[model samples]
Target: MIEAIIHGVILAFGLILPLGVQNVFVFNQGAIQPTFLRAVPVVITAAVCDTLLILLAVLGVSLFILTFAWLKTVLFGIGFFFLVYMGWVIWRSEPLKVNEAEATSFSPKKQILFAASVSLFNPHAILDTIGVIGTNSLGYSGEEKWVFTLATIIVSWIWFMGLALAGRSLGKLDSGGGLMKRINRFSALVIWGVAVYMLTKI
Candidate 1:
């Protein structure tokens, strides 16, 4: 069981280490958004998705997602197109134009929904959760598999939550909007680069 948990953590770390589209988007949001509070939903959604895919893998259902070459190809195409579109949107998006008046009326729910959509539909996330984490579950037994899956989910939550919260704490150095815009632009480029890498891999 201990070995299985360790294996799951290591696998989770490896998958999360890559600069996926979600990482770029979340980091961008953290830098540009008024409050770090906006990122909680994104973290939760990502973590839940990770757990679901891991469970499917443990149940031996993920093999079908991989075995169908035509399906994989189709998903790959759809995902690639969407990623490119999203990357363009993120790149072209205006940076940190938050109106203080509007900020007072801002809804956390809307931000969460946005975060959820971004995390859930992300192409790299689909592959990582359904392909890497899902397939890796086969190495463990019943309880060990459970432990492994939970640990994987924990990694997602911790990393994303940290990013979201960290942005708030770090916002101090950049009191002016100028620094935030630079960070947003930099993160957008990172996202664009990652999206392209994913497309080529597919």
Candidate 2:
């Protein structure tokens, strides 16, 4: 049981540690929001989406879905285009000042919508997530499987909150928003690169 917990933690961090669109967006919102509370919608939405995916993967639902080749292809195509659009929108957006954040920052509704879109549609997140967890979970069963699954879920929630906290620290330091501007463009480029990679798969 202890081994299962450790394995789950390690595997989850290994999968989530790499750069990805979902991570980038969450961090970006954390840095631009007027306060930590303002970023709660994004953090919650992303965490929830990840939890749902993890549960499905561990339960064998994802494996059943993967049996359809066309479904995978269709998902990839949609993810690719969504990433492209997100890249463009993020690239052009300027980070807002604390005084201006209320007027210009992403509202809670927009944040939830975008967070859900990136979380649900990003094939990179889905494939690697479901593929790895679903396969690894095959090693455990019953209570042990659930324990492993819980450990991974905990890691994911903590990681996103940490990312947001780190971003909030940066946001406080970058009062002029110059650093965030560069980050936004760089994030957009990273997103586009992922989109291109997804394009190749489709």
Candidate 3:
């Protein structure tokens, strides 16, 4: 059980450490929101999406679904375009002001929708959860498998909250807008880079 938990933590963290589109969006939302509490929707939505994916992967459902070649192609096409659009939006985002009005802030619905898109539309994320985590689970069963799944799920939730907190800290430091602009540009690049990679795979 200990070994399974350790493997889960290490593997989940390793996969999530990359600055992918989903992570970047979560961090950006945290930085843009006036307060950490206001970023809860984004954090929760992302975590929930990951949880669902992890559960499906562990149950072997994702593998069965992905077995169809046409479905994979369709997913790749949708993900590629969605990522490109998101990248453009981020790149063109105006610099956030310290005193930005609440009226201009993203509504909870928008936040949830955007978070879901970032989390669910990425083929890489799906594959990582299904291909990597699912394949790893093949070695464990019953209690061990449950322990491993729980560990990964816990790590995912904690990591999302931690990222939001870190972004909140950075937001405080970025009152001058310089740092914020740079971060946005870098995030856009990361999103675009992932889109390009996906395009190549398709």
Candidate 4:
């Protein structure tokens, strides 16, 4: 069980280390939100999406879904356009000011929808969770499998919250708005780059 836990943590962390669209959006929300508590919805939504994917993968439901080629193509098409749109929005977003009366804010509904889009629509995320995590789970069974699943889920939740907090800390440091603007631009580029990469894959 200890080995399973360790394996789960290491594997999950490794898979999540990449600066994917989901992580970038979560970090952006954390940085732009007025308060950490206000950012909780985004964090929770992302974590829940990942948890569902992981659960589906581990239980083998993802295998059935993956059998259909059209589904993958559809997901990729949706994801590509969504990423492009999100990147454009981020690129054009004005630097949020602490005292600005019209500072932009994402409502809970928008946050949930965006979080789900990034988590569920991205072919890379789906494949990673289902392909990597599911294949790995095949090595364990019974108590070990449960332990492994729990560990991976816990890691995901912790990682998302940690990312939000880290972004919040950076946001605090960039009170002047200059650094924040640059960060926003860079985030947009990264997102668009992911979209282009997805296009190539499809």
Residue ranges of candidate 1 with Cα displaced over 4 Å: 97-123, 197-202
Best by TM-score: 2
A best-first ranking of the candidates according to their TM-score comes to: 2, 4, 3, 1
Give candidate 4 misplaced runs (Cα > 4 Å): none
lDDT of 1 by residue, 1-202 (tens): 8887788889888887776666755665665566666556556666666666666766776678778776666666665565566556555655554443135212456445445544545555666777777777777777888998888878877887777666656554555656666665676576566556656656
Question: Residue 129, candidate 4: how far off, in angstroms?
Answer: 1.0
Reference-based lDDT, residue 86, model 4: 81
TM-score of 1: 0.79
Cα-lDDT of candidate 2: 0.87
Mark the 10 consecutive residues where model 2 has the least summed lDDT.
Answer: 96-105
Candidate 2 per-residue lDDT over residues 85-124, each given as its tens digit: 8889889998876566576457889888778878887786
Model 1: how far residue 20 lies from native, Å: 2.0
Query: Candidate 3: which stretches are off by over 4 Å?
Result: none
Taking every candidate in turn, the Cα RMSD to the unseen true structure, in Å, is 3.3, 1.2, 1.6, 1.4
Which pairs of residues collide in model 2? none
